[model samples]
Target: MPATVTKTWKLFIGGAFPRTESGRTIKAVAGGTVHHLCKASRKDLRDAVESARAAQVKWAASTAYLRGQVLHRLAEMMQARHGEFVDAIRATARITPRKARDEVDAAIEHVVCFAGWTDKIAIVLGSQNPVAGPFYTFSGIEPTGVVAVLAPDASPLLGALALACPALAAGNAVVLVASERHPIPALVLAEAFATSDLPGGVCNVLTGDHGELAPAMAGHRDIDAIVAAASGKRATALKEGVAENMKRVQVVDPDSDFTDARWRSPAVFRGVTECKTVWMPAMA
Candidate 1:
């Protein structure tokens, strides 16, 4: 071997990979192999939020059926690149190939499941309400604009997918912060997404320290909500950061079994969605 070149992973923002504006790099070591990943700063977080905000409206405007198709296409892309995901998870997570394969399989399954829900969510989340007067009232679900997802340190691929798929299913733009310790899998998934039908900026991945970015995500004025897997003091800090704007915060157990049946529930989308009640003339 003449020379060894290490690749510095870039942040996925607005459907493109860009080096962090802060120009900081963090190293992740796995089995004597070192990987360089972008260290996203507060400024990077702001930029991700801006991209998400810009994409949210158009994404939300797409027909539910189209959104469902796009999501399913993402699943197909993941399946196509299944081996890459398995290897990434295995290397960073230090798991057996079989276990890594399982995680990748689960992640693909999770994406397909959420793809089905994109169209069905309205049926589960919306309702026709009884009105007192000669008016028809309906409650419909709407995307919560831009959402920030903080992936759990463990099960990097599955954990990130579990949080992100729901928000995407509900037609919200996402700003995903991959696991600090093992972010390669998330970035790998980002590559699959890049080739999929997902609109640019619809799902952005930032690789960096959650401790540094979570508070920034919580306090960001443009981010409408946060879905994170954290506990104890880490969880508390995230919650406290939302005091100013009161952004919707949903903190799940970091050790949550992502394979749990509850992940499929329409209720899972509630945190990242809003209910809009419309009243119209009965004749119309």
Candidate 2:
């Protein structure tokens, strides 16, 4: 009989998997198996922020049509690994197989939904403004740069995808903090991101205690905004920490159904994007 090889999950940063600088590990039980996962530290968070910042510039520079293509590729990658995601969710979330499959299906569908929005956002959110002068004025949307995402403990895959797709679709880079309790699903999903056509550093995943990372993320000067599936003190900590820099912060109920149609609304992109208005002299 051959011995089965176990895999140790590492932090996904800059489109690569690496161990934590702190050399810390947390144990998680899934599918009657114990696995070791890298426990991210403040330093890890800083690295992710740096990576995201660098990538956001190029990602935002890409044409909206190109960005949409990248997002669709990501969805295809997720679909390729559908069964693995379903199993991970079932193991860690302790949900029935059918429910787990449904979550994975919804997550993939949401990614495709957001992909369609990338190209349409300008048409839907931008506008030509009427000014009382001989000038042409218009307002357009731009990415907010690096965004930090805090995923809920339950529905790890769906929650993370739902919150992150909006930011990515808006052309912003993301640093995602996976569920502290059940991170297997998020880590598994990271594999798909690595293989997808999406550029490196566009999406990074960290597995650790949210309490430790949320405050650090809030105070991160480079991070332009945050969208968290959290509430109570955790949410409050983020609000208070970002006061100094006035960084944008949004909180969603962790318990909310990520598959809801509201999550797919174009309004979700507002927080992740900045609206800019420009005026130019009109040619007669």
Candidate 3:
């Protein structure tokens, strides 16, 4: 038997692994094998978005409890594949086995944490109040619809899944741009999602050229929000670029601890609808 892995998996899109429409491949070392590039194009992005949109209405309307269950199922799937996730991370990101497993575990934990938030949002963030008038008014949260995420290169699995968990938990469909450094985890996560009973486009992952596709995302009217984990000039550029769609941006501290207590709160989450009300009356 061979000691080194000779083959790796393909990009998951529309519930399948497809060759690039461009019929092109980039040569890269994945799992100790010469891996072929799985090129994704603008059309693929649209297709993925369409699937996500189709799933949106039902997913958005789904009770927070059901959404949470779906996420917990996803976490279970991920936990079952924990070793494989670690192996893929170790191979692609070039991290120690312990480090790889930690990140993978952190991702799972993030999903489960967010899952708990689904039903608890009302208790934590919503409120019932006297309208100060004859009628009564109440406040609640809502999903922001489709959100596109640009996964950070440093901690591929963590950042991608971190943003994904909240993005989806809040009932928003998500599209993640896989990190250039480690695309394998995104694929594996995509596979886990495939088994999670999520809507087809509810969580889409693509591995491709960021520069080329980012502009399209920045200006996309369909996308309600966008998040990117980056440094230096790239961060600045993305902030300005997303202006066309007015997508919300959430910048994270790169050096922060993964298991920080602050992450448990809903205020820390981004990419959701927050309704503010104002009441004014003039008395004679």
Candidate 4:
């Protein structure tokens, strides 16, 4: 009889797959097969933050058109590997095939929608101020640097995409903590990110216990912002932990439908960006 090959999955960090420093693994059952997924530790979170911090400047400096093109390429990659996402969602979420397909489709569409916003967001949010002074003042939005996202457990892929796409579109490097309950879809999504034209460390995925990882993400000084799709105590903890850094924190409504057009609003794009006004001498 031929030998069966079993694949071991690791955390996605710095554009590479590395085992968790803690060396802990969680058992996940998918399609009647058992798999071991890395349980990311505090050290892993720190490493991810370093990578994101290093990559954020270059990513933010890229032209808006280039950013849009990269994001669009991500959408195309997701569309090409649509079946893999569907399968992962079905396996981890225990949802029917039809529902799984719907989730996967929604995720891809969300990416595409956010991709379009990469080039238009500044126009929508920025403005030229009418001042009496001879100088021309204009306020423009810029990325908030490293952003941490807590993915919703109910809809792993969809929720993660909902929170991450806007951040990425705004030129922020992201460290996404996947759903503790259903992380397989996140791992599959990480693969899509790796193959996409996204710069390394722009999007890092970690799978493990949210309770343990959320604090690390919230308290990290390098993380300039946080978008959490978690509610109740989890959201409270995140908000409270970030008090030291006073980092921008947004706790989204857990019950909200991620597939709605509302998620694609300019508000989402603006939330992860900081506005700066530049004053220049006007021609007399």
lDDT, candidate 4, 186-217, per-residue tens:
99888899999999899999999988887777
Assess the local accuracy of residue 193 in candidate 1 as a C-alpha lDDT between 0 and 100.
80
lDDT of model 1, residue 94? 67
Ranking of candidates on TM-score, top first: 2, 4, 1, 3
lDDT at residue 187 of model 2 (Cα atoms): 91
Per-residue lDDT tens digits of candidate 2, residues 1-284? 99998877999999989999999999888768988899899999999999888898899999988988888898999999999998888766768889998989899999999889998898999999999899999999998889999999778999999899999998999999998788888998899899988898999999998989999988888888999987999899898857858788999998898877989998899889999999999976
Compose the digit string of candidate 3's lDDT tens values, residues 81-200. 999889778766667888988888888988888889888776677766677665555667777788778787777788787666777888888878787667777888888988987767
Which residues of candidate 4, in runs, are more than 4 Å off? 1-4
Cα RMSDs, all models? 1.6, 1.1, 3.6, 1.4
The CA lDDT at 206 in model 3 is 82
Please report, as a residue range, the 10-residue window in candidate 2 with the lowest summed lDDT. Answer: 239-248
For model 2, name the residue pairs that clash: none
Runs in model 3 deviating more than 4 A are 1-8, 253-256, 276-284
RMSD to native, candidate 4: 1.4
